[model samples]
Target: MALIETRDLRRVYDLDAGRVVALDSVSLDIDKGDFVAVMGPSGSGKSTFMNLVGCLDKPTTGHYRLADTAVERLDADGLARLRNREIGFVFQQFNLLPRVDALGNVELPMVYAGFDRRTRRERALHALGRVGLAERAHHRPMQLSGGQQQRVAIARALVNGPSLLLADEPTGALDSRTANEIMALFQELNREGVTIVLVTHDAEVGRHAHRLIRFRDGRVTEDHRQVPVDARALAREAAE
Candidate 1:
């Protein structure tokens, strides 16, 4: 079964001046281990779609079945529980706690999930190692470089071993070199059987994904498969 399936998903916002449609009859399916990139101009419903997929918001109409569970049928607490268990979010900002070290920040989610301290520490350490940040686990966000901080954020996202990774403009704040590095890490993770859905306005960044879905006027205008550019190759070329 498709990991994420949405049929005629729609979202509308009521305002004093009537209603505004943020997503209009959108439908798509994302399978396990697929790396899909969402692209669109500002106000094109990309963020709205991401929010719905991430369970941060619900749709106004239509069906969304995540892992075969009807999302629209879930209550607030149920949705929150599902999100915590199934989705990992990486934002443009690192979003690390300023006062906490990398290990502590990564362990926060597990704490909320009711994990014991020992298990949380072990899992957080493993996640940090996966992101190549194990050496910096004790460092605070301020002590790390932009790339390092973003790595920490990725570690925190993966610490729960979520079924899906949702990244929204995750490389927007980094320099080109660091962005390439981050993309390489994402590529590596995708190869390891992690499903990823990323939203970005940058075409260059989108080219790294196996599938691209473009949005316009609250609708998906284009969807296509592509041979993704090798981020590791690009990084190597830059170093030469």
Candidate 2:
């Protein structure tokens, strides 16, 4: 079965100005290990779609089945559990606690999930190692570079061993070189069979994904497969 299946997914809001349609009749299936990028201009429904797909918000009217579980049927606690078990989120800001070191930040999710102290430390360290940040585990967020902070965020996201990763402009805050490094890490994760759904406004960033889906005016305007740009290759060429 597809990992994520949405049929006619629609979200509408009733504001003082009558009604607003944030998303309309959207349908798509994201397979396991798929690397899909969602792109659009402001108010194009991309963020709305991401919110719905990440289970942060429910659709006003539509069908969304995540891992064959009816998402629309889940209560608040069920939704929280599903998100904790099945989804990891990476944001543009690399939202780490300023006073905490990398290890502490990465352990937060496990703490919420009720992992034992020892287990949380072990898993957080392993996740940091996976993102090439093992040696920097003790560094606080302020002590790290932009790329390093973002790596810490990625490590935290992966610490849960989530099946699906939802990243919103993961590289948007970094310099070109740093952005390339982050994208390379994402590509590596994709190769290792982690499904990713990334939302970005940059076409260059979106081109790194295997599939592209574009939104416009509360609807899907484009969806297709493409040969992804090799982030590793780009980084190599830059170093040469």
Candidate 3:
């Protein structure tokens, strides 16, 4: 089923100079368990679309349905509740608490979800393990490398078992080598059936997804999937 559907989605800002259309009547659908990437230049509507999809902002017009819930009709509190349960976000900055260890960082979402201490601990450990960070669970963010820190951030995003993972420029701050490692992690998660929507300007990064959606001048310009990466390529990557 389509987990996300948007029909003529739009966002407009009333500026001093004139009305600015940040998003212009965009329509799209993303099915469950799909790995999709959104790519565009600075002024494109991709970021605006991401905000709407992430429930961080409301659309100016049209419809947005996420997991069968009409996003536009929800009140602020309702939206917050839905977001808490349904969306997991990974940002470019890693966004970890400097003093907090990996386990504590992963436990944060469960704390917000009101899980009991024991359950939170168990789930946090499992999530950290999923990201291959179990051994470093006690290490502070500053003690970890950039790739490891991003993995912790990924674990935190997964701790709540959210229906969707929304990543915004997740590798933007990392070096090429570190970025590839994180992308491989994302692929692993997707292979395990997590739905992912990644936003990036890098074409190589965007190509990692099962499908690509490109935006330009506040509208969608292309939506298509390319050939999957070969196993040989993946094996070579792993050996590096």
Q: For model 2, how does the per-residue alpha-carbon lDDT over 1-240 read when each residue is reduced to its tens digit?
A: 578999999999899988999999999998777789999999999999999999999999999998778999999998898888888999999999999999999999898899999999999999999999999999999999999999999999888988799999999999999999999999899877788999999999998999999999999999988855345543443564
Global lDDT scores for all candidate models? 0.91, 0.91, 0.90
- TM-score head-to-head 1 vs 3, winner: 1
**Model 1 bad stretches (over 4 Å):** 228-240
Please write out the lDDT profile of model 3 over residues 1-240, one tens digit for every residue. 578999999999899999999999999988767789999999898999999999999999999999999999999988887777889899999999998899999998888788999998899899999999899999999999999999999999998888799999999999999999999999988877688999999999998998899999899999997645334534543564
TM-score per model over all chains:
0.93, 0.93, 0.92
Pick out the ten consecutive residues of candidate 3 with the lowest summed lDDT: 228-237
Using TM-score as the yardstick, the better of models 2 and 3 is: 2
RMSD of every candidate to native, in Å, equals 5.9, 5.9, 5.5
Show model 3 residue runs off by greater than 4 Å.
Answer: 227-240
Local lDDT at 160 for model 2: 90
Could you tell me which residue pairs clash in candidate 3?
none
Candidate 2 off by > 4 Å: 228-240
